[model samples]
Target: MTLVIGLVVHRSHHRLFQEAARTLTGVRLEWVDYEAEDEIRARTAGLLDRQRLDGLLLGPVPYARCRDLLPPDLPVTVTRSAGLDLALAWCRALARGWPATPVSIDTFDQETVDEVAAALDLDRERIACLPFDPDQPVAEIVEFHRRFLDRFGGRYVISVRTGVVAAFAGAVPVLSGLAGLGTIRAELHELALRSQSKRASERRFAAGVFLIAKPERSANLDRARIGLMNMLLNTPEYADGWIEDRGRRGVIVFAHQALFEAVTHNWVSLPVLAQAQDTLGVRVVAGFGVGPSARTCVALAERAANRAEQDDSPGAYLIEESGVMIGPMGPAGHPLHFTYRAHGAGIERLAERVGLSPATLSRLAAVERGLDGQAVSPSDLAGSLGITDPSGRRLIRKLSESGLVIPEGSAQVNRKGRPSRLYRLGIGAALAAGATAPAGPGDAAGGDGGRDGDGPVDGGRRDG
Candidate 1:
């Protein structure tokens, strides 16, 4: 299938994005060009209504403008100017005979600015930076540049915001620090890969095991099972699924992962469990598993269902092939738990020490195990966790500060743009160390009061 990618670009960057998109094969680019940020909402809405996009690629400005309009499942990539772009901009300033020091830069993070300065052997203290804030008004950003220029007597302004350049009105030299062609092309390629991966994942086999939580008696068990199977067969959400009797008290449904995702609301909740409880007068617990094969999926689903049955209430749990577990997904469900199979206490203690939730640590541990000691980029981690790329980067920083990850060079997934730094998770080793070490003073206090069971752990909410 030819992937349709929606490109939400400003008029100034449209040509560059188009040029980058030319390199992509087996994909069609749908342009939603806007002159101003305010126009993004209408233009993006029009494009989405008119075309079905497999993925979306847009700048931070357009993303901030119309993030609410984007479909929750769409693969969206927000392109940002990397440190290389900033370095090139500095090179241009040098060629123009402008002093690099006493320069104000906007949009790029302070870390990038510092890195660039360090690499170029320039004074970091003199380089004023206003990092990108999606909520900051363009006028406020303009004023920030003006104030910095007036106070520091800066030689020039380097900005990623196209509007800021014209706003300057020839008052100062504003070098456009937009993402270069290389960065745009790399992002486009990444988005295309993501779209293809998403499509393939949707087609993968998934299984669900629904068990009667409290069967009345052996005499009525078969009746209850049959009724549950009937309900599943009648469910429009399960229309495409293959429903059958799994055991005396359990019913199984086999379907594509996409069907189950919709039925379970992306694994956040299980409305069918509640329906069975209300209508059948018997509480039902469900477990869903996604895997590459039918047999593996069923085995995982049965294990997940057993885990859910241990809970006091009717709820659902999901176990992916990668070993990530999420559970208790009903109306009265607690915060989602991304739990380790057996290393629960160690994860909790490590999470407390690092000032992170055990659930987040558990998910990271699962990701690490799946990698089998291979390093991963923050973007890859983000995709695995259903989070935005920036959030993944922040998580990486936190893990780095806690010494829970080791930097392992970088990998350039595409031919252009800056390569992504890779990190190997130290979680398994950290868990082993925490297990053998004597309990510290904090450990005596129960260390965040997190338990080692399949109980709830905080901080599993997906980022917007």
Candidate 2:
């Protein structure tokens, strides 16, 4: 599939970005250029509405302008100028016989500025820095440079912001510190990889098992099973699913994870469960599972179905190969709960050290397993836990402080804001080393042994 990446850029830098991405194959760059920052919102909205974008690439200015308009799940990468860009800007100032020292620099981090200054042996004290703040108005940023210039005489200004250079009206020399082609290309490639990974995840094999509650002796069990199969086959949402009888009392559907996500509304609710109860005049429960293979998926589904059967009402549950379980998903369901099997003493101590429940740690372990060594952003972890993005960020901080997660760079997901920092969850490895031994075979890992209250407060309605 051709990945469509929405490029939200200022008209001035549009050509540069296009050139950087010229060599990319199997990807289409949909340009959304704006003459002014204010035009970003409308243009971005139009692009999103008109095209099915696989990912997004924009500068910090454009991201700040239209962050709220982006979809949560869309892959985004906010391109930033590297230190090389800053050095190049300094070179330009020297070329023009303009003193590079005592200049005010905007957007680049202070560390980056200091590094460049030290490498060039420039006086750090003479340089004024205004770090990037997405919430800071462009006017305020312009005012910062003007104030710094007024207070301490400077040679020229360096800025990554699009309009800042022009805002000066040539009153003071302002050299553009925009990201270099190499940096933009790197971010573009990363965004593409992330988009591809997401697409692949959606296509992973998934299985669902629907079981009818034990009927009266006189009731025809085979007939009810047949009716359930017919109901699933006739449903438009299940068209992609291969439906068949699983046992005398159950039916199973096999399909890609994307099909199940659509049918179950991302596991928030299962209208099919309710529909079956109403249509067949019998209680029905469902278990959906995602795993590496068909057999594993079927096993997980059966376990999830068993869990759903324990509930009093017709409901559904989801179980992933990672050992993450989300359940009781009917109209009467409560807030989503991430339940896991109790790990050994090592996990308990580790959880205590990290200030999280052992169950939460277990769930993190499961999430790490599912990642298969892939790095994830805090938002991604939050989605797995069915929690808010802010909560996810907080959780990451907590884990980071305890050395439970290793920083793995960052990803610019579908926002014009800061890139989401990525990390490799260390909990899985931590468990492997800390765990005394694996759980016994007789021990039911799928049972609701441990319940972590860290799940979404509003149930699993939040997109995962």
Candidate 3:
């Protein structure tokens, strides 16, 4: 087995190992900082959803209310002083023989259990002392030995250590753990630079979130990157207007910043990614960049997310037109007076795809004019549906957002001191048109959309 050494981060050990490194042969130096609960969770979740990290190190992080969020199989080592607080967690893993638990204590206070027990009225058998020679150089000192102390079944038997240590790593020998920390130092630095206790609000940029899949993996990691390219370069369903040069690493401001905060706070297991972190797809990492324009943030967030893979490292997947998931998604807000008036709907799959609400849908007949069968811009169509011109622009965006309509081509026309946009339907519209062919005489409903999933069109009667 290759040995990986990670520095301990906790309040138990106050000294730096004054010696050369040992674990770097196969391990990496992980940086862990205490961040707000949500940030930490999102970071870890984002990682775990992709790459597989062999170990995790939560440096000096207090084992507060965040024990359960971590996956049980992965080996974990923490550097916090209050072990007793995590008693329930210990009791849990101990009951099932699950691994991934540990602690680092000081030699001067080997008898910490007695003190900890008295404070909580618990027995000593629940806690055990994992030894590390304090005087030995840093590499020799262990951080999370308490994880192994699952002997003697007793309530509240946990460990406690002293002060912050340099590095604390967690691991899952058979697989990679997407380890992450609540980045505190960097946050403080950014806050300090801005001269505000709270962050100054700014408008976030329009970003895209999508899913992609590849046929193979390459050292160049091109399969996934190219998959991302396929998502951004050609599709005309969503964000077609701004596919510029593959959407470089521009700023991704989010309205879902609040949602990211919510997810990070709620879930554990930080992210461990292994692909597309530095390319045309880089702009989508803003899972928590929330502020004034919150809805936009939500929209962008709905588009991007990280998913974990097994066997090897993790990969990122974008669920756009060319990504893992295809077809149209329900656009937020109402269409005409109908909340479900978003396009990609109509007979056959129409009612079943969208809950029936004829009152709201009848308004679509008023969705402005393309002059008989004349083509009109998506923006104008959405406007006829009551959305502001710019917000209506979302409907005009392409494949990345919805697989319902693909633009045949785009052209610009100048009219009355303003530019008029022109567009022709692509694959999605064509599909719907083909599918909408009138049903035969035996057809029960005038349409043949999604009643197929509900039941057969044949009328079933009582056997009286």
Quote the lDDT for 62 in model 1: 88
Top model number, TM-score: 2
Cα displacement (Å) at residue 206, model 2: 1.1
Taking the tens digit of each residue's C-alpha lDDT, what string does model 1 give over 1-464?
34668998889788899899877875656799888788989999988875667899998888988999998989999999999999999999999898988898999999999998999999888888999898898899999888988888997899998789879866788998899999899999999999999988887899999999866544588877876775664343453456677879998887789877777777888877766776677889999898888999999999999999899888889999999999778844222222332353576668788877655666567566545555678887776655678888988998999999999777555566876787878998888876755544343321223222222221222110
- Cα misplacement distance, residue 333 of candidate 3 (Å): 44
Model 2 — which ten-residue stretch has the worst lDDT?
455-464
What overall lDDT goes with each candidate model? 0.77, 0.77, 0.31
Alpha-carbon runs more than 4 Å astray in model 3: 1-84, 89-115, 120-392, 395-464
Return the lDDT, model 3, position 412.
33
Query: TM-score for model 1?
Result: 0.61
Alpha-carbon shift of residue 406 in model 1 (angstroms) = 52
Summarize candidate 2's per-residue lDDT along 1-464 as a digit string, tens digits.
34568999888888899899876765666899899878989999988875667899998878888889998888999888889999999999999888878899999999999999999999998898999997898899999998888888886789987678778876887899998989988999899999999989998999999999766631888877877776664343454456778889999888889877766767788887766666677888999899999999999999999999898898899999999998778844222222234353666678788998765565576556545556678777876666788988999899999988898666555446776677878886776686676564433332323434344421321111
After TM-score superposition, the amount by which residue 35's alpha carbon in candidate 1 deviates from its true location, in angstroms, is 1.3
Candidate 3 lDDT tens digits, 358-456: 222222222221122234565655533444566446545632143333343333332224444454333334334545455444333112111122111
Candidate 1 clash total? Answer: 0
Candidate 1: give its CA RMSD in angstroms: 21.4
